[model samples]
Target: MRPEIIRLLNENQEFRLFVRQNPQWYRKLSRDPSALQSLEKEANYFYGRTFPQRVERMQSNLGLAMMMMEMLKMGQDTVAQTQETFSS
Candidate 1:
C-alpha cells in the first residue's frame, strides 16, 4: 500500500470513518484505476500539505543540532585553553 494512503487512513478520522462505513466501495476503489485516480489525487493533496511541514520541522531540528555542536566545540576550546593557562 502507498504510504500516503496509509497516512490518510491513520491521520484523517473522516476518511477512515468513510472507509469503515463503505468497505465494499473502498475495496472497489482499491481495484479500479479510474476511481483510484481520484483517491490518489486526494492523497496527493494531503501529502503536498504535509511534506512542507515535515521539511520545516527537519530544518528546525538540524539548526538546533548545529547550534549544539558549535556550543560543544566552543566549550572544548575553552577547557583546553584553561588547561594550557594553568600548566604555563
Candidate 2:
C-alpha cells in the first residue's frame, strides 16, 4: 500500500471502516492509487454516507411516516363516526 493510502487509513475512520468492510477496494487501491476516488464514491453510496443518499433515505422515511399518519387519522375518523352512529 502507498504511504498516502496508509496515512488515509490511519487518519480517516470512515475510510478505514469502508476499506475494512470492502476488502476488494484494498487490492484495487493498492494496484492503482487513482482508484481511491472510485472507492470513496462506492463506499459513500454503499454506506449511505453521501448527501444525496442521505436525502433519498430521509425522503423515503418521511413518506413512510406520512403514510402512517394518514392511516392513523383515518382510523380516528372511523372511530368517531362509529361513536356518533352508536350515540344516535
Candidate 3:
C-alpha cells in the first residue's frame, strides 16, 4: 500500500472500514489517479465530520478537570481553616 493510503487508514477509522469493505475500490485507488483523488476527498470528509466531536469531548473533559481542581482547592481551604481554628 502507498504510504498515503496507510496513513489514511491509521488516522481515519471510517476510511479503514471503507477500504476493508470495498477491496475493488482500494485497488482502483491504487491504480487510478482520479480514484485516488476521490478517495482522498472522501477521507477528508469523514475526518471533518469526526473532528468536531473530538473537539467537543476534549472541551468537556477540560471543564470536568477544572471543576475537580476547584473542588480540591475548596477542600484544602476548609482543612486549613479548621486547623487554624483549633490551634487558636
Candidate 4:
C-alpha cells in the first residue's frame, strides 16, 4: 500500500470501514490510488451514506409514521362515535 493510502485508511474511519467490508478495494487502491474516488462513490451509494440519500430516507420514514398516527387517531374517533351512539 502507498504511504498516502495508508495514511488515508488510518485517518478516515468511514473509508476504513468500507475497505474492511469490501477487501477488493484494498488491492484496487494499492494498484491505483486514483481509484479512491470511484471507491468512495461506490461505497456511498451502496451504504446510502450520502446526505441527500439519508435525508430522503428520513423523510419517507417520517411520512409513514405520520400516516400511522393519523390512522390510529381516526380509529379512536370511530370507536368513540360508536360508543356514543350505543349509549344514546
Q: Where is model 3 poorest over a 10-residue stretch in terms of lDDT? A: 41-50
lDDT of 1 by residue, 9-84 (tens): 7887755665676576476556663565565455555555467777887999999999999999999999999999
Per residue, candidate 3 scores C-alpha lDDT tens digits across 3-77 of 777786788777778778767767776776357667766666655655776788799999999999999999999
Clashes per model (N, Cα, C within 3 A) = 0, 0, 0, 0
Question: What would the TM-scores of all predictions be?
Answer: 0.48, 0.76, 0.47, 0.77
Please give the range of 10 consecutive residues that has the lowest summed lDDT in model 1.
40-49
Q: Model 4: residues >4 Å from true position, as ranges?
A: none
Q: Which parts of model 2 are misplaced by more than 4 Å?
A: 50-52
lDDT preference between candidates 1 and 2, better one? 2
Model 4 lDDT per residue over 1-88, tens place = 9999989889988889989999999899989999989988988888898999999999999999999999999999999999999999
lDDT of 3: 0.77
Candidate 1: misplaced stretches above 4 Å? Answer: 1-49
lDDT of every predicted structure (CA atoms): 0.70, 0.91, 0.77, 0.93
- Give Cα distance to truth, residue 7, candidate 4, Å: 0.8
Which structure among the candidates has the greatest TM-score?
4
lDDT of 2 by residue, 1-88 (tens): 9999999888988889989988988899899999888987887888888998889999999999999999999999999999999999
When sorted by TM-score, best at the front, the candidate numbers are: 4, 2, 1, 3
Give residue 23's error in model 3 in angstroms. 20
